[model samples]
Structure formats: C-alpha cells, structure tokens
Target: MTTPATIPTAGDEKLPQAAKQSGQALQTAGRHTTQEILTFTIGKEAYGLDLLTVREIRAWTDVTPLPNTPPFVRGVINLRGAVVPIFDLRVRLGADATEPTNANVVIVVEIGDQLCGLLVDTVSDILALSDDAMQPVPATAADADHNFLSALATHEDRMVALIDVARLFNRGVPQVSEAA
Candidate 1:
C-alpha cells in the first residue's frame, strides 16, 4: 500500500527557517490550497469524499441485522468499542442489492460527530484535485435517489462523484434493530 509522506517538524531556529521556506514553496506550487479526495467504486462508477472525512477502511465483515429498519441500512457492526451503522451503497444508489464479495470494503467516515460505515465494492487511491476540476452536479445527476452528492470531479480521464457526508446524515439515522 502506498503511504502518505510525513512532514518533518522544526525543533530549532535553523530548522524553522528552512521549514518556512519549504512551506512557502509548497504554497507557491499550489499544493497547500488543493483538496485531497479519497476515491472508491460501487459497481462500475467512481465516487469520492474529502480525505479529511475518511476515518479508515476495513474489509467487509458480517453485520448484525437490525429490525424494523429501512432496506438500505445493512445493519450495525461492533467497530472497536463503538456500534457503527453500516449502509449498503448499492441499495442506497438504487441498484439491486447483492451479497458482499472478497473485493468489497467498508469505508468508515465521520459525518459531523457521528461515524458510519459505507459498504462499497472497492477502495481506490487518494487523489489531489484542484478547485477548478470540480463541477456542479448536473440536473440529472442531482435527481438521483441519493442526495449526498454535492459535485462531480473529473480527473485523470475518470469521473468521480463528490459526496457530501454531512448532508447525507443531517437527519437522524433510523435505529436498526438487532432482529431483522
């Protein structure tokens, strides 16, 4: 797996001067202003979210069924010590639901103070995108059953829908029962 580079900190006056120069160079190169996005796939389509909102990625696992909940909600999972609700992205995207396969993954994301898992087909790499590369979602795209998409990003000859995590869970999520 490719890992992000760690920035070295300044602990002395000389280091601070070098760090300031490097920071200015980065800013001049437009690196500090560009937003990084983490992309993933569901079926054949690509989607993205702000890299800052992504908590972690995990392999698909068995989720405990919740009773009297919407069909789109798969169930809840015990993540570490917390109970996290998992949503099936296929169902939420108006696609027919299917069983999880070896390639499936769960993308844990933070929406405000709430954490939830999004079950997707695969996890792709993080990408850096400039503000000019993003465009408003077309009317047809905005009319989808899913209301979380805020914009569409075109990068590296591919299209990625930008999801708004906060808007997705602005309303209280329905409680999932252990028995479904």
Candidate 2:
C-alpha cells in the first residue's frame, strides 16, 4: 500500500502555501486529485497536454514529406509499422515552422482513434498540478480561438497554456491526416 507521504509529486513543493496545506490534508486521506500534464516548449512559450493522451516521446527524425499537405503537416514517420503523421505544433499554433534539430522531439498522442505526433522544440517536464492551479483561458482569447486551448495553468510562477488537441484538430479532419 502506498502512503500519502510515499507518493511523489512535483507540484507539492510549488503550490501556494494555503493550497499546499489543503493538498496535504487531502493527500493524508489519499483523496487528492492531481492533474498530470506533459509540458513542452515551442519557441518561447510553454504548452501542456493531458498526460493520458500521450503515447510516447521520440527523438526528432526525418519524415517523408507528403506532397500537397498543408504547411503545418511536416509529413509522417513509420512508428512500429504504423504511419503516424507529424504536425509541426509551432506552426499549427500560429508560429513559424520549427527547424528540426537534435533538441527537438515528437510527442506521440492519440486523439480519438487517430494517433499523431506533435513536433515540439523540447519536452519540458511532466508536472502534477492541482485542479485549483488551472484557470480558464482568458475570455478574449477563448472567444477568438475557442478550440485552441482548454485552460491556463500556473506553475513555478509560469503560465502553461493547456492545448486542447481534440478541438484544435477537429475530429475526422483531412488537414491532420488521411482517414485511418
């Protein structure tokens, strides 16, 4: 049996004092709800995704470019005999295309029945954040780009924008990949 003290977490040390106290109380009873997020950086911004959606993280490798594909679709790579399309997240998020390098990585994630890779500058850290730390996306930004993000979480005095992969890539979309 795992005791509260035995359970490890990164957010426990960075939570607000009061929230930390409350978290400890909940932890003691083994009832704490910690949201695990996979954080990564694109250019200068921090972004996060639900850890549950992530399948695996792979080092950047050359992909076979697909003709007629959108700019964001950098092409696909064969993962264990399965062809997975790689999307340049920086470009998809309205930034310039990322110049692939050794520092870059592909975050393989499953959305619905589709498995795809998100090309990011670097894989930051997997953080366990409390629900209270997550705030709704700004009203103006949400209204303008409703599907782009789910929420904004504050950790270590930094804001990590939570990417809503499902909404961002809309189900059964040709722009993301071919029907599979």
Candidate 3:
C-alpha cells in the first residue's frame, strides 16, 4: 500500500518545500524563468501540467458516476472524504473513451480552490524547462483540444502539450457549494 509519506497533497506542504530546497533558483542567469511540468499520456499523444498544481497520483480506482454530466466526466471519487471530480483525458480531447486498467492513473490537481482528478493512460516525466524552450500554441490549431493547450514544449525530442488547466471546463469542475 502507498503511504501518505510517499504521496504529496496540497495539504502536505512537503512537496513544494522539498522542491524549493532543490530548485532554489527559479530563474536562470539570462533572466529566463524555469518551469517544471508533469507530463503524462492520454493515448499515444503526450500532455503535461504545471508541476506546482499537481497534488498526488493514484492508481486507477472505480469512480461513482454522476447523472447528467458530460461524457468526458468519468465521475467523482472520494479522496480523504472530499469529492474530487475525475475527467477522462482522452474523451476531453475528442478521442475515444478509455477503458480503465491497472496501468491507468489518476492525477489529482488543484484547478482553483477545488481539487479535481485527471484520468490518464500513463505518467511520464517531470521536466524542468526554460520559458524559451516553450512555443506558443499556433492559432491555426484552434479547437476544443487546441484551446486547452497553453504551450508546446519539447523534451528528449518529444513534444509535450502543456494544458491550460484553468481554461478547461467552461463551467468549472462541479463543486457542491450548497444544497441543490
């Protein structure tokens, strides 16, 4: 079983603290800002998110489906008592749905004040890249998937689409603010 000590959540400040200890320098000598990205796979394509926003990684677990939600929304999972909505990355990107397998993983992240989970095929690398290494998303590729990408970064000769977490979910992750 995975222990809490091994996994870092937003409540556990250890992650950012340890990261700061190692990456004390956020900027390079030439005034270039360095950013850390957590890359993962939806299918064959690669995607990434800001490392600072990632909370924890969980093995694929059965989620309780909700009614009247989009197909992309796989459902919600209770994480330490909080209901975190999980979205299937493949379906969200206009691809076929994913069949849950032992190899799948759920990446919990903070979209704002709420916590949400992104269901992905596999977790890849944690890359620290400079701002200049990232290229802006070309306007020509505008679409549902394209709109979600803020930048395209290359690492080890592979292009990783950096997702704009905030821009996803036009209505935001469904949070139960009050009794409906």
Candidate 4:
C-alpha cells in the first residue's frame, strides 16, 4: 500500500497585515483564495515552497558522487536522463545529516533555468493559504544562514521557512562543474 501524505498543522504565529486583510475578505465572502505551497520537513522545522516552482518529488535514489564536492552536495542523479544536482537540506540547514529512510523524499525544483533537487526528511502535503496567511521575514532572519531562507509563511502556531531556490548554492559551497 502507498504511504499517506503528511500535512502540516497550522500553528499560532500571527499572519502579516496583508495576509490578515486578505483572510478577512475571504471570511466575509464565505470563500477563501490561497496559493498552494508544497510543504516539507527539515531538521525539526517545517518549510514550504511555491507548488508552481516544484517539478516533482521522488524517493531517495542512488546519487552519483562527485569528487571534491561539498558535503552538503549529496551528488547528482540522472533524472530522466538529465543529470540534476541534489543538496541535503539537513546540512544546508546546519543540522546533522542522517541516513535516508522510507520517509525521505527528493524535491525537484526549477529556479530560473537551473534544476536542483532538495533532499528533505519528508514531503508534507500541499498547503493552500490565503494571501493573509503569509508573513514578512523578520530583520533577525537576515542574520541567520544566508542560504537558509527567502520568505516566511505563518499558519496559526508555526512559521514555515520558504526556501530560496536561487541562493541554495551559496558562495561557500563548491560550485558544480560546468563540464558535468
């Protein structure tokens, strides 16, 4: 039998003003309009990305290791004949890496013209949040790991870190060989 999909639990964080107003509008109209977000888990926290940007989610597959590659770069996988680099989300989040389990999933996403797979602990369900559900990233967030986040979304009690796909490979990380 196939495994059941995981869905994120809404938390208590307050929504941003814009999202609040939008939520209010939807509530009054008896309808809600929300953007679909593909949520996932990294370390102990929840994160999400725009579903439109996600191409596919695959189970953990054998990665072709590259010499001199950074530890976070789990290596590349032949995704339908096209080699796509995969990065371990745990390492990228400054967490200790763990062995992949049945719950692990590789989230393949396209940012601009570059395609990359994010190795996450598990794939959560698609979150549909009204405009008011999103919140602004705090100033302190700028001081955190540069590549750790790009945006923030609040749902009741939890804050979801929006991955910045473009900056996933920061300056400190070894660049993938163009010749590959």
Model 3, residue pairs in steric clash: none
**Superior by lDDT: candidate 1 or candidate 3:** 3
Q: How accurate locally is residue 34 in candidate 1, as Cα lDDT from 0 to 100?
A: 51
Q: Which digits, one per residue and each the tens of the lDDT, describe model 1 over residues 73-158? A: 88899877778899887887779885898789999998656678999999898888765677897777546456679889899899
Ranking by TM-score: 3, 2, 1, 4
Candidates in order have lDDT scores of: 0.76, 0.80, 0.80, 0.73
Model 3: runs farther than 4 Å from truth? 1-25, 177-180
Q: Residue 23: error of model 3 in Å?
A: 14
| lDDT tens digits by residue: candidate 3, 1-180 | 876657544455433342354352264465556888999998789998989889999999999898888898998888887888999988888889999999999999887787888999999989898777789887775564458787899877799999877777655456643222
The alpha-carbon lDDT assigned to residue 155 of candidate 1 equals 97
Stretches of model 2 off by over 4 angstroms after superposition? 1-32, 141-146, 171-180
Clash counts for all predictions: 2, 0, 0, 8
TM-score of each: 0.76, 0.77, 0.81, 0.73
Q: Order of all candidates by lDDT, from best down to worst?
A: 3, 2, 1, 4
Lowest lDDT block of 10, candidate 3: 16-25
Q: lDDT of candidate 3 vs native?
A: 0.80
